[model samples]
Target: MPISHIEHYNLRAERSMLETLRDFYVTVVGLQVGYRPLSSYGYWLYAGERALLHLSEARPGDPREPHLRSTFDHVAFACTDLPACEAHLRNHGIDYRYAEVPATGQRQLFFSDPAGNGIELNFAATPDS
Candidate 1:
């Protein structure tokens, strides 16, 4: 059997940081806090009906390796409204860099979360008049 697309991605942090992560993903990333069946300290963020991001609380004594966090370059999310996203990031006082794909002209905004996890937002190129 073939595997399908990514069902979801999870980020684990301490309880307090987990809450902050939830807030950031919800408020800044435009995800909604939805029903999470697991009765744990975490959140399930949904783009529509599907929960694409999961925030979990890291338990004490859980081994956290530096390489584990830094290995993956970043997690990217397809986005729209480049201007609005830029404004939102600026309003939140988050520093971000802008770039475009030379071949596709697709726009991208890169920034880090409170926990220093890289986040990328990709936008379709705007049409010329």
Candidate 2:
């Protein structure tokens, strides 16, 4: 079958960083912490009813470095309330870059989580935005 859409992305890190990243996604990114059916020690972050991101505890000696450049560039989410989202980022002292698509006029906010995973928040073109 042909691909439809992304189901979710998992971020594996140390427990401390995993918790911190969870809080960042919840508070700053506005995703909700949701139920995970599996027995693994981790969290499922939801955008509405769908879990868009998963956070898992890293195994011992797992050398996945967040800061180091990787082939994966970023993960993007279709979002709304651009102003409020920007305010949340600023209030948390998180740095982000803002842009607007020339063709569609969609507004976008770009930033990274504590684990250095790039995140893009997109707001559809609107008069209020």
| Top-scoring candidate (lDDT) | 2
Model 2 lDDT per residue over 1-129, tens place: 999999899999888888899999998888999999989899999988999999998888885666778887789999878878888789999999999899989989999988788989899999654
lDDT of each prediction vs. the true structure?
A: 0.85, 0.88
Task: Record all residue pairs in model 2 with backbone atoms less than 3 Å apart, i.e. clashing.
Answer: none
- How far off is residue 66 in model 1, in Å? 8.5
- Clash counts for the predictions, in order: 0, 0
Measured against the true structure, the TM-scores of the candidates, in listed sequence, are 0.90, 0.93
For all the candidates, what are their Cα RMSDs to the real structure? 2.1, 1.4
Residues forming the 10-long window of minimal summed lDDT in candidate 1: 63-72
Q: Best candidate per TM-score, number?
A: 2
Q: What are the runs in model 2 whose C-alpha is more than 4 Å off?
A: 127-129
